[model samples]
Target: MKKVAPPQCLQNAFEENGLTQIDVFEFPEGTHTAVDAAKAIGCNVSDIGKSLVFVTETLNPILIVMNGADQVDMNKAANLLGLPIRKAEATEVRETTGYVIGGVPPFGHAKPVETLIDKKLLEKDTVWLAAGTPKTVFSLSTRDLRDVTGIETGVDVSA
Candidate 1:
């Protein structure tokens, strides 16, 4: 079997952001879900940074980078952002981020979207995130993630 390459968008973003330490890994089986990624990488599920997209009441896009072990509390998240929020549909997610649901990274989006980092993810030294493809992922430290993504302080938006 032939190996698959990482998505160009993800590659360009990593390079432009100076994420020299980020290393993309590909799994033959696939890592579309947190459980799948954790199993493939031999890490705790919480160490997987799940990038989720949501739509604010006003129809703006918001990106939430949460720990795989956690679940987003829409009400609490809405309160934090001061706007009612709902999960983005498949089409909406692809259109807004230019990536599919299982492949969206924390950054490197086609356009800028409001971003929030889950505090739980900050507790880990390293976390894995989708690399613009379900079969691929990359690792980065918590601090480096914040620096590269330009995300400020983490928040308690997960339950």
Candidate 2:
């Protein structure tokens, strides 16, 4: 069997952060949603930490990690961050994060940007997140996750 090449940025982040990388699974196109990703990984949807990329009116990029079953409350997020928030279009997401909409990881951006993590995601010991590609995901402990990624916890980004 042929092996798939891992996303370079994910590998780079693992190296930079001294993290023990988990396994990644690749699916065919159009499996970017949490439900579809869970199906591909043979896990529950809530186990997937949906990485949402948003842009402020200033054009600054930010990442939000939420439970797959939850939706981000933009108004609440804006109030928390004290900035006007807007859903980043596909073009802007790629331009700022160097990753497409469904594949934006919680960490390892081209540079550091503010990050907000939903409190609900803490329920699990480990959560799966995108690895710079729609078809790829990796599992990391929720506690140790911040060691490799700069995530601000206790934010209610979920609705």
**How do the predictions measure up, each by TM-score?**
0.94, 0.90
Give the winner by lDDT.
Answer: 1
lDDT tens per residue, model 2, 1-159: 112555777677777877745666667753488997888878889999998888888888888888998999999999988899998899878877778888888877766767888888877898988877777777889886866665535578887
lDDT of each: 0.87, 0.79
Task: Write the residue-wise lDDT of candidate 1 on 50-89 in tens digits.
Answer: 9999999899999999999989999899999999999999
Candidate 1 Cα deviation (angstroms), residue 50:
0.2
Show model 2 residue runs off by greater than 4 Å. 1-3
lDDT for model 2: 0.79
Off by over 4 Å in 1: 1-4
Q: Pick by TM-score: which candidate is best? A: 1
In model 2, the Cα lDDT at residue 59 comes to 80
Clash count, one per candidate? 0, 0
Screening candidate 2 with a backbone cut-off below 3 angstroms (N, C-alpha, C), the clashing residue pairs are: none
CA displacement after TM-score superposition, residue 124 of candidate 1 (Å): 1.1
